[model samples]
Target: MTRLVAANRVISTDGKEIKPGVVELDGERVVNVSALLGERPFTEWLGGTINLQYYADEQLCAYKDGKML
Candidate 1:
């Protein structure tokens, strides 16, 4: 299902904030992020978590036995 996440400011590709932003999310992934334009209103969940994930990553910095193997 699709959902909406509104906020005062949202992150942009240029590393800036966009006022009145609405982030469209598909499940736990972000599908779209754009400014709230015109009179398009949302009729879905306001704010909530959708299966968040968190794990450690050591790709380039992976070390074995205190040395790069």
Candidate 2:
């Protein structure tokens, strides 16, 4: 996951504050990010649990923890 903001402004909706902008993805699809990395600053957020065990043939294998989820 990666977060980016336009210049100095953060992305917001409905006057709700969302800072540090981020993009969360599952496989190739995007998912919720605000609740996902709520604890870290948006500019400093990284997927909390990632265990990439392999990289081959331009493919990757990753894990969040034991049992694959």
Top model by TM-score, which number? 1
Cα deviation at 27, candidate 1, in Å, is 0.8
CA RMSD (A), model 2? 12.7
lDDT (Cα atoms) of all candidates against the true structure: 0.46, 0.35
Candidate 2, lDDT over the whole model: 0.35
Tens-digit lDDT string for candidate 1 (18-37)? 66666665654456666667
Report how far residue 51 has shifted in candidate 1, in Å. Answer: 17
* TM-score, one value per model: 0.52, 0.24
lDDT of 2 by residue, 9-66 (tens): 1232233433433434355333433433344444433334433333345333333433
Q: Which ten residues in a row have the lowest lDDT in candidate 1?
A: 60-69
